[model samples]
Target: MASATEGAGLSVDEESPVSQKREERLRKFRELHFKRNEARKLNHQEVVEEDKRMKLPANWEAKKARLEWELQVDEKKKDCVARGEDYDRVKLLEISAEDAERWERKKKRRNPDPGFSGYAEAQLRQYQRLTRQIQPDMENYARQREECGEDFHPTSNSLIHGTHVPTKEGIDRMVEDVEKQIAKRSKYSRRRAYNDDADIDYINERNAKFNKKAERFYGKYTAEIKQNLERGTAV
Candidate 1:
């Protein structure tokens, strides 16, 4: 039977055409995988080099100090958690004066190529102002509830509500905030021709001047109309 099959065209050691095709496919797949891996490594190395060029600290010593300080903060937080205390209360280790100065200098340094514009800066300031205005009150309320939860004893049927009644000052501030926002939006609509890099200060000053002039002209026109009506002038 084996001799007959061999004569017909099938042989075990001669390797079947299907097996040869499978071997070729596998070899091509391995070569493709190796090339992809090499490309990925090269890309990663390029990213590392770019990050190195954008130095956060001038020297290795400053970088080392920053890392050590961060690690110390992490350890402190862990220890606080282990002791069943509030991790937020765990203060991070402060950097040395030299390191602090280095960090501040780095912080103030502007990139040669700026990625953001004045509008972006204004938006960021608005965002920070809003956050600062709202977050502390919210956090205080949350902290109060959390502290209440830490009690082991439950007072049944005690109707206790967290009261965060807005004060008069807060209400006045809210109204002022709304007015300011309306003014800002109105100003933006009126000054639609200004470019992205246009100076906000200059635009504001010009707008203010125009607004004052418009107000004076309107006031005088209204006064003349009232005088004409009282004097029985020709209609």
Candidate 2:
């Protein structure tokens, strides 16, 4: 009976460790499941917040309808115009003489109105621009003169003819000066990148040029019509 009790006690203690390990694994699995659920909830909330932020522009449908209606009116007007029909439905604004005089005065004020230049104007302007570009480097000039020895004085021709001794420092300085000049030129000579995918409806270069001029003259007045046409919402 005593031996049997000892064996049973040992077996119970051995089974206790196995049960504890299984419980530990179950606790870890439950923790991971809870963490995953919380993560999913957080992601769902973030998505909902993002969707709230991204909303359509206010009254877009009504604005689109109005644009379509205006486009229809413009198309009808153009058709009447092409057919040589009297489309006198639109009323023209009548400006007073005082308003016209005021507008002329405003234009004159806006004009810089530099007085007329004579035959030598181009040459004079070129010289003026060159003079304006002349930035004197007092520090570099003084340092160079000091290093060339006390007795060395610059003759006008010496610096102009590029007769300087070639050294590593001199080459580096020249490179720096060239880079600075390039930087200055780049600021003034920048061109915008051309997008190849833009709507180019013209058949040729001449037609394209005419289209550009036409757009420049009338684009602001017909922006809504253009948008409606592009959206295929034109009546």
Candidate 3:
């Protein structure tokens, strides 16, 4: 009887060490996972707070100012029309000297070429005035062309090459095309135009060489040239 009881006690003491180890390991794993989740949650909150703090009010203000200026310009245009004056021929009113200088600085920053030095605020104002004057005629021309089923080709007498004379559709189309070309050429032109250390003469020379090559290619491809002419893509 005593041997049977001792055998039972031995059996009870023989619990598996591996099972105990596994339970401890599982506990540690759960603790670590919980800590990691908590840390991630804290990090996310920090990011949200940082984003809120970094949001700028300046851009909103600038946008508001631009909208106000546009409204004022539209009001002036309406007044000119009411007076029976050619709204398109209205000249730019004189701006303050400070504003003019600021505009000049901005222009210089955009196109740093010494050749661009002659581009004063006064010149810009004059150009704007001319553009305004021609806009109505351009619209009328486009309307007429569409009505008559004629090709609409407007020519500009402005000193700037390729400035299409004011016709609403023509001006709009030309401006869009010009903007696209500017973006396409930005990679090459930015370095030449904006880089202070860049040599302007070298840039000009490269442009001249490229233009000559383009001209030669266009001359050889008469069919392509004709297509471009018809599409108004030559410019």
Q: Root-mean-square deviation of each candidate, in angstroms?
A: 25.7, 30.3, 26.0
Relative to the true structure, candidate 1 has a C-alpha RMSD (angstroms) of 25.7
**lDDT tens string, model 1, 1-235?**
8889877664665567779999999999999999999999999999998898777556877888889999987998888888988776444244567887888899879554344578978688778767767625676567667866644234775544554466696688789988988988787665445467743433566785686686587967677776787689555
What do the candidate models score in CA lDDT, each in turn? 0.73, 0.78, 0.70
How high is the lDDT of residue 63 in model 2? 88
Q: In model 1, which regions exceed 4 Å deviation?
A: 1-9, 13-15, 56-235
Give the clashing residue pairs of candidate 1, or none: none
lDDT of 2 by residue, 48-75 (tens): 9777657656786798899999898788
The best candidate in terms of TM-score: 2
User: Candidates sorted by lDDT, descending order?
Assistant: 2, 1, 3
Candidate 1 lDDT trough over 10 residues, lowest sum: 150-159
**Angstrom error at residue 90, model 3:** 56
lDDT of 2: 0.78
